[model samples]
Target: MLEVRDLVVNYGEAAALRGVDMTVRSGETVSLIGANGAGKSTLVKALMGMQPVTSGSVLLDGEDISRRQASDRPKLGMAIVPEGRRLFKDMSVKDNLRLGLHDAAARRRGADGLDLAYDLFPILRKRSRQLCGTMSGGEQQMVALGRALVSRPRLLILDEPSLGLAPIVVAQVFEVIEAVVAQDVTVLLAEQNMHRALSLSDRGYVLADGSVVLEGTGTELLQSDRVRTAYLGES
Candidate 1:
């Protein structure tokens, strides 16, 4: 459903991504795993049109959207739960989620989208009026996920969804993601938690120093000597 070809991005003279190529098939969950400086987030930002692409093409359902504005991405069936959650801390939970429906078509289906989110995280319904900043980190993360899901995107991109949460909360978040996958939404997960990410993925890509170092099915990757040594801390 999404294809990235020869994708490159630079911050002035320093390249953050170099000729990266990857694809996410319809209704599949793909994981991008790497260390802190591996450019996983950069690639995610580029895909969402939040970062400037130096040279490359991003295609969604065969349409080149590399030049589309960030605001236009959601309307074209793309949504992201960005790194750090990036929620409106001062806004009410419901208001924050409502922002996801800015697109006219999504707005028309807003009620259903909201229902899906509330169903996925029932606590959200109870805390709809609370200020996001006051919620615990796990609750805040739930809000972020709900906001992205509320758009009913075809391709859902989650960047570092497990970052900064307790282990139990991380497990819960992944469970929610699993439910999302069951519903047929194509997911591109950029995560540092290799084991969890690959375990849930249908396919996985290993990024290193701005390029794809390895790509394979999830179980294949998990058992790889290289992956075990590099990311999994095995000898």
Candidate 2:
């Protein structure tokens, strides 16, 4: 559903991404694994049109969207649960989720999509009237995920969904993601937790210094000697 080829991004003289190539087919989950500063976020921003691409193409469903505006992507059936779960602190939970329906189709889905969100995370329905900032980290993450899903996106991109949560909560978040995958939403996950990322993904790519260093099926990567040494901390 999504393809990025020879993608490069530069900050003045420094290149944040160089010749990165990856693909997420329809009805599949793909993971991008890398250490901090490996250009995962850069790639995400570029794909979403938040960052300008110095070169290369971002194709969605076979059309080039590289030059499209950031605000235009959501209308084209793309949504993101960004790193850090950026949310409105003072907004009620329902109000926060309602922001996802910016496009006409999403707005048309309306309360039906809201129901889907609540079904995905029942806690969100209970907290509908509560302020978002006062919620726990796990709760906030749930809100972020719900916000993305309520948009009825065809391609869902998640950045660091496991960051700064207890192990149990992280597991719960992964479970929710798996549930989403069961519904056949194409997913592109950028995560630092190599084990969890690869485990949930059908295929995975490793990025280093802004380039794709390796690519394989999740199980293949998990058992790779190079991956075991570099990312898995094993010899």
Candidate 3:
């Protein structure tokens, strides 16, 4: 559903992504696993049109959207739960979810989007009017996911969804992700936590020094000596 070709992104003279290439097939979850500075976020940002790509193309369903505005991408069926769960703390949970419907196509989905989000995370429906800032980390993450899902996006991009949660909370979040993938939404997950990311994905890519160093099926990478040594901390 998404294809990134010879993607290059830079901040001044510092390269954030150096000729990275990757693809996410429709109805499949693909993972990009790497260390803190390995350019995973850069790739996500570029694909979302939030970051300027120096030279490359971001194609969604075979059309080049590299030059499109960030706001435009969501309308084209892309939604992201950004790395930090950048929620509107002062707003109510339902309000945050409402913001996701800014796109015309998403707006057309109307109440169905809200129903889908609340269905995916029932806690969101229970706390519809609650302030986001007062929620727990896991609950806040649910709100973040709810916000994105309310857009009725075909492609869901989650950036480090497990970043600051407890082990139990992380497990809960992964369970929700599993449920989401089961709904037939294509997903591109960028995460530092190799095991969980690969475990949930169909295929995985290892990014290093601003480029893809390895690519394979999830189980293949899980059993790889290089992936184990580098990301999984195994022998």
Clashes of each: 0, 0, 0
* Tens digit per residue, CA lDDT, model 1, 1-235: 8999999999999999999999999989999999999999999999999999999999998999998899899888789999999999999999999988888967765558888889989999999999999998788888998899887888899999999889998988888788788888899999999999999899999999999999999999999999999988988
For candidate 1, the 10 contiguous residues with the lowest summed lDDT are: 102-111
Task: Give the per-residue lDDT digits (tens) of candidate 3, residues 1-235.
Answer: 8999999999999999999989999989999999999999989999999999899899999999998999898888899999989999999999999988986788885558899889888889999999999998888988888888887888999999999888998988888888888888899999988999999889999999999999999999999999999888898
TM-score of each: 0.96, 0.96, 0.97
How far residue 78's Cα lies from its native spot in candidate 2, in Å, is 0.4
For candidate 2, the TM-score is 0.96
What is candidate 3's local distance difference test score? Answer: 0.91
Choose 1 or 2, whichever is better by lDDT.
Answer: 1
Q: Global lDDT for candidate 2?
A: 0.91
Please give, for residues 1-235, the per-residue lDDT of candidate 2 as tens digits: 8999899899999999999899999888999998989999999999999999999999999999999999989888899999999999899999989988877877765547889899989989998999999998778888998999997889999999888888988888888888888878899999988998899899999999999999999999999999989988989
Candidate maximizing TM-score: 3
Q: What is the alpha-carbon lDDT of model 1 when measured against the actual structure?
A: 0.92
Residue 53 of candidate 1: its Cα lDDT? Answer: 93
